[model samples]
Target: MELPEEHSLGAHRRVSEARHTISEILTRSQNEHFAKGNDLDFSYVSSEGGRFRVNVYRKDTGIGATFRSIPSEVPTLEKLALPPIVTKLCDFHQGMVLVTGSTGTGKSTTLAAMIDHLNQTRRLNIISLEDPIEFVHASKNSQVIQRELGTHIPSFAEGVRAAMREDPDVILVGELRDADTISMAMTAAETGHLVLGTLHTTSAVKTIDRVIDALPVEQREQTKSFLAQSLLAVVTQVLVRTPEGHGRRAICELLMMTKAIAKLIQTEQTHQIPSQLQMGRDLGMQLLDQALLAAITARTVDPDDAYTYALEKRAFQKYVTDTTMLSKLDSLAPAAPVPPTNSTD
Candidate 1:
């Protein structure tokens, strides 16, 4: 059979093919007694070699599907073009490491990479509770158990509570979406398990606020204390198309918890967390603008894109232009030869 032309495969064609494929997959899985649910989903690469994380839902007519590409292979920290500091978070044995960003910013991929690294290098048991389990990790040196939300358990909170009994060293909660899940995750972290999770927030401070605010007003104070004590780091990332226009790269804002940050969180003065991050480079903390500025100076990302996401736009503009800051940035950039001037007209 001839495949539809790329351009001719419009939304309708794509949707129709998706619906048909999903229905077929569901029918086959059901016939095999796969115990698929009403909201059955799976992640796989297509025949064309495009990786996809898909959701199949039962509609009135039939099954409908929505798919997101799961890059063929997991990306290394360098392959993703993330900053070096990102790896530092993985060094911690116990605490919470959060990857926060807007939807479609590759948060799941980043978390998977970290978990994969641990699975390969650390001889520990890792338990992941995902709604649909996006990435499938094979057991390397570590034992990996991936439990799906609806199929394996009723919810994230239940999965987390049950993971405690499994004696997992590392727990990956797909998302900290609600109060119950967040509270359980905190408990896991405080009890000496390394908890990794994602949040839909733009900045480091906002990520902190989102967690604390997820709890009730009366519980806010105690929640802050719990977070301040167990929080290890928050990595907020954004995908920007490269200036050369090849593809995309991530610019991350990493907030490493420090004494100052902990104090601020404990005192309920999270508004000051950004400034603390701005000044706490000694602790490996950085603001989003700092990462953007570095990307801009290296010419890895466009200046406008960097400026747009910068938390301190004016400071970022000045840092990109200020001779002192430029000198520092230039030192960080890759070494390149000076261009030769033309002698002949």
Candidate 2:
């Protein structure tokens, strides 16, 4: 596939050279990561002294890999543009804190920031299980151990089980993609280990529902109870282009698991979460649409961008102030066709 203009390295050298380079990297990664099988789902590759998480696969054109550049220096929460509320999550002793969003929404970056905060402030064992291990954290006040999925272990479920034996004070499961992993993560939290995980869900309420619904029907009730007892907070973010068009900003929805929230999750009344979040302004909780409105009001994000990520498009329409964006919004609404122009035609 052709690379995007921004991430592209320009038309440097020949196409064959680029393909050859990518092929060689894949060969080395496969040999190092998968010695017994030919699967290449996820792997890490180092190029030009920088590490990248690569997803290698076959395309109709040829073998292709998508590269995500990992920053060498870990950024703090404030530097990453995360709300100040997220910093408190690092201070939680034991419970599951989830960073959730769609792909390319900076979930990994936010998790890295949280881990970095813990590394600087706490003297404890921190274990991380990632598919390719995006960020590398050095031991500071904390003892940090990062294990890759295929390199250090086989899967996240197995890794979480192993982390329990490692006597970890905190465990970061790269993602909670399945029932087994989610269950193990909750157990880890229940057993007094702070667990951080990521999910691909878009909103707080959906995230809670996703976790419960990921389990078997019989296991769901028990898992909901586990989640109700162990979940600390759910932070959902979406990246929006800045008004200046130079960089992107994170519009966040933060749900801190309060007493009422715990009851809601336990009783499986997740649909009422938005109303609770609206009333939780003093607790630093905000819905995704609220966050977007704040960004729009601050003039940092385009109104149309806010509308794109808003949960309720009709409700968010009132916030569009840009004339061009308003025109676009108007165009999207169904138009009433002129009644048959009888004799005028």
- Taking all chains together, each candidate's TM-score versus the true structure is 0.78, 0.86
C-alpha lDDT values of all predictions: 0.80, 0.84
Which number leads on lDDT? 2
Candidate 1 wrongly placed segments (more than 4 Å)? 1-18, 27-51, 55-66, 315-345
Error of 1 at 4 (Å): 16
Candidate 2 per-residue lDDT over residues 293-321, each given as its tens digit:
88888988877778888867777777666
Encode model 1's per-residue lDDT on 33-109: one tens digit a residue: 43344565566566787766776555544444577776656677768767667776767789899999998888988
Error of 1 at 204 (Å): 1.1
Q: Predict model 1's lDDT versus the native.
A: 0.80
- Overlapping backbone residue pairs in candidate 1 total 0
Candidate 2, residue 158: lDDT: 97
